[model samples]
Target: MSFKQPLKAGAVIATLDVGSSKIACFIAQMTDDEGGFEIVGVGHQASQGVKSGIIIDINLAESAIAHSVHAAEKMASRVIKGYPLRDVVLAVPATSSESHFVDAHVQMMRQNVTENDVRRALAKAQVKAQKEDREIVHTIPVDYVLDGHRGIQNPYGMSGQLMDIDIHMLDADFAHLKHISQCTEQNHLDIVSLCSSPYAAGLSTLVDDEIELGSIVIDMGAGVTSYAVFQSGRLLFAGGVPVGGQHITSDIAHGLTTSLADAERLKTLYGSALATISDEHEYIDVPMVGEQNARGEQHVTRALLINIIQARLEEIFEMVRQGLEDSGVEASICRRVVLTGGASLMPSIPELAQKILGKQVRCAQTLKVKGLPDATSGPAFAVSMGLISYYTQRPYEMPMEIASYGESKSFAERFKGWFKENW
Candidate 1:
């Protein structure tokens, strides 16, 4: 089952991000052999098919996916006809994803820690992950504890009768994965892998040192904010808040009596999460729908708009703080918080997040790529770039699918094929 042969040079792969606010498509070719990769095609479009971080209407989702992918293909001077681009590495938000830690102990059957022992321990951990009414999406091995020796990175080639493992498994609600699968399948695409949004963002933005020591990656999307804690190159905590940039837009629309579209444009061009009366002298031209006043009502001061957006942004970060606290991971460990996604572009968002999270925060930007537009290299492209980087590096583990024959049935087998639906 191993793809041992060297992949062809200039092998092109595609990544699709069906985000809350936008659907982004990326196509890149492997370069410099296996060490470096380069981008060749990219496309993005405003999403009308999704809402609240999940795909609700399959038809709309399919159209949106096709639009983004086609544009990228055109840019690459290629056409992915039919199901040529079926397999892909997909990213999903944490709103519907769940995670838990499981510990397993195996006797090793009078032998040292062997491959079978590792499999058995993983089986126990998987069973524990499915104890609740959810389906397992990912099973990650954190560390192994063999006999009295703890923190053993590899238990194999060591003499120990008792094999113990600490596993970090994630599960998503059945309905959530099914809807996503349907949306992609209807569009003639097959999800080869389902990646956590935070993990996907971390793939490109996080460096080796940051992951080894500790860092928090916060992916701020339109309708949801996803966070991940990485220590020793493993995902320690993952979760998301139900609120995001959409909330800020809603607040501005309510406070200023403007349409949602106008509020969004204002937020992108002039809104800041931190407001100061000293900076209130500047005024912005607001599009008026046949409304005018001698007091200059059509033009509004920037401070008022900032004040409204700031309130919502503050609440969202507070909820993120609460989520970190609830995960039992000390906030002190995350001295560096990297902000990515569309909402991270706000002028003073990094400063605002640092003030609230008590950590050094900065916007996440893409790196080491060519043929990409300047606008696509900013913090907003972190997830899209990460998706590309993920396919290039192939870092994450794939889900183990049960074989048809000669496969031992474990307690975790009950959830196999659970996600299949006609849709």
Candidate 2:
């Protein structure tokens, strides 16, 4: 099927991020200025039926999605009895996403490069990137080589006999994506586009300097921590580790013998990745598990809580380090590390990340998007805000119907035919 038409100026666009810990929705209107959009409404609810960034119960997921959407609609002052939200940009997890590099070349017809030539090269690369059970989510042209000269960003007006392009393609499990689509459809929402979690996070947190100089964005979410590498203003690699903030909470609950709710409260109030000298003297009240009243409350030193939190966070960063190495992009991630998400709010996380990841680390919230409320401007909302930014940027390819060229035709001949037919 052909892709949906791009949003017009002043058109309302909604984005939904079905994260492992929370389901968030944002409604915004596109502006006339390029890369300019404003948030009009926002809604979020505690995530249920989702674990490690994947949906486990469709019914519960659907309800949570519906609730968040309705809340956003109400805030926007736009409500409908039937299908109020028709289209929404969705964010998918990077748990099973894979990246593949493909190269394609086209022979010039009149010694001048054209958009058609780029499209043909991209189509060829796309064809080669196909897998048996996976679907392509992103196809980004990283660099262009023309006549042996490399690093060409705009080769449209350049002259070259052979145009070679290196494309980075991201693919994910088809069944997992299909299930996500099903859950959205249950709420009468049409999937406008599916963006990877890491890609969205990078878009939201990375600045122009970081993108140009190369950097890594770590989205430390509740149930999963995902990272993506950006170089030359494009995403180069994306990966995720299943461990996240929720795991630490679980560990605290288990170690302290408390309820999950109380453990979460304690983690948010006093959690730290590194213990200080004063932690031993600081005392906190802990409600023992299966306790009926205040009699079951226990006092534990802050040192004990920090120990549990620190152990889990250290393991998470270690896994992140290994995942980056396994991705083979460790060398490219040289500029700095930017951490976002609810878990990143921990006081000592940036310090721990710098010590373990061996780079300068900074905890970042979402960049300033106009009309975004202060309440929703933290790291926890990075993915959702990034979805809006992605919609405004519209970095993906536009779906087009191409005319078929005969098998006997050469590359130049097919390029001419496709170019004439389309443009």
Candidate 3:
């Protein structure tokens, strides 16, 4: 029942990522040695009833989740009918997520600072961050100032008269969280923890140097493009833009007079974020929309398709640049940008990102996760794999309290049910 404990050797962990394009499930076992973890099973299905990373149709979303979980279970040789899967770590996109800074000054009672003093300061900051309707998803202590000396990583057992602490907290829409929880519950899964998608993707892709030197990780998914800022091995900011690969697909469909499926195929095969002179000679057969009488096929230059994709992608990068500026993080810290996710696979996307974002840009694939299939080990799977990495590296102490669904059931009743099932 304790979520704070790390996954021990031989312990099993499951992660579920519900994105606008797909629902991914992963099952892994902690290795006995430093090999870390092994992917026992993996499953993914085309996302349905979800739009812009939000669940719209509960039944359809639940069915998609169930199918994904079942597929992973079959691969792992675990059957849900006999031994039910109970808990899962969920990855959620930060749609409309906001960041806030909370500062607290605590007068130390004793001569030396202890764990209690640090805890008290964090608790006071959390109190100040409390809002009526918002749910705080992450409460990270960015820096600790002990007796006017700042940037102390850990203040415990230090001698100080006063302790000043600054915390970065991320808050999400409560209604969105409730809907996600309900959908997972419908599939008989209890959410053990939640991690932001962009943050997770960064963890899975960025190298240690990239994190320490400060960088931005942009996850361009099907329906939403999310980014996270990291510096000194901690997440500084997270935000998302509604436009993503799906929007590009729709634009291609409209611009070329083709169906959605055909547009997607073309986007995958011939899409490029930057156009060259040679593109004019490269032609693609585009299907005409609503043409039923032998006028279905049309020839279009690849340059046109690249133009359409470039327009939308430029806008996306511009939005990201503006978001970073609004956050007030210096451009120097975010000098490097790492692009990931499905949409980032388009040719020359890195070049386009560099031109628009004005940063050194590179497309990243997911870091190797033990036993992960080569086909499934790509940038698109970064978030799901990062969930596993997060669990393995998380501290023993739990930080923020997850917001409840505001149910009418009593605490005793809920605890009893959870205990009975898990114990």
**Whole-model lDDT per candidate:** 0.73, 0.79, 0.79
Candidate 3 local lDDT, residue 45: 97
Kindly list the per-residue Cα lDDT of model 3 for residues 1-423, writing each as its tens digit: 123446677777789999999999998888863328888888999998899898889889889998998888778764223446556777878774677777888998799887666666665665566665665567677788998999998787789999998777777776676777777776777766667889889989999999988999999999999999998788888888888999999999999989999899999999999999999999999989877655789999999999999999999999988988888655456789999899999999999999888789999955687778787898999999988877667532224331121121232233234323432
State the TM-score for model 3: 0.90
> Distance from true position, residue 138, model 2, in Å?
0.8
Per-residue alpha-carbon lDDT of candidate 1 for residues 1-423, written as tens digits (9 for 90 to 100) = 121222357666677788888888877766766646667778788886687678788788878888887777777664323325545667777888876877878887656666666766666556555645566666667788887788887677688888778777777776776776776666566565566788788877888888888899999889889998888777777899878888898888788877788788888888998987765898987654335544434678999889898888888889998999998765577688989888888889999999889998878866557777786787666777777665555433334431111133553244434433442
- By TM-score, is 1 or 3 better? 3
Clashing pairs for model 2 are: none
User: RMSD, each candidate, Å?
Assistant: 3.6, 5.7, 4.3
Q: Give per-model TM-scores.
A: 0.87, 0.90, 0.90
Ranking of candidates on lDDT, top first: 3, 2, 1
- In Å, residue 194's CA in model 3 sits off its true spot by 1.0
Error of 2 at 243 (Å): 1.1
Tell me how far the alpha carbon of residue 415 in candidate 3 is from the true structure, in angstroms, after superposition: 12
| lDDT for 235 (candidate 3) | 84
Off by over 4 Å in 3: 1-5, 33-35, 78-83, 292-294, 396-423
Candidate 2 accuracy as lDDT: 0.79
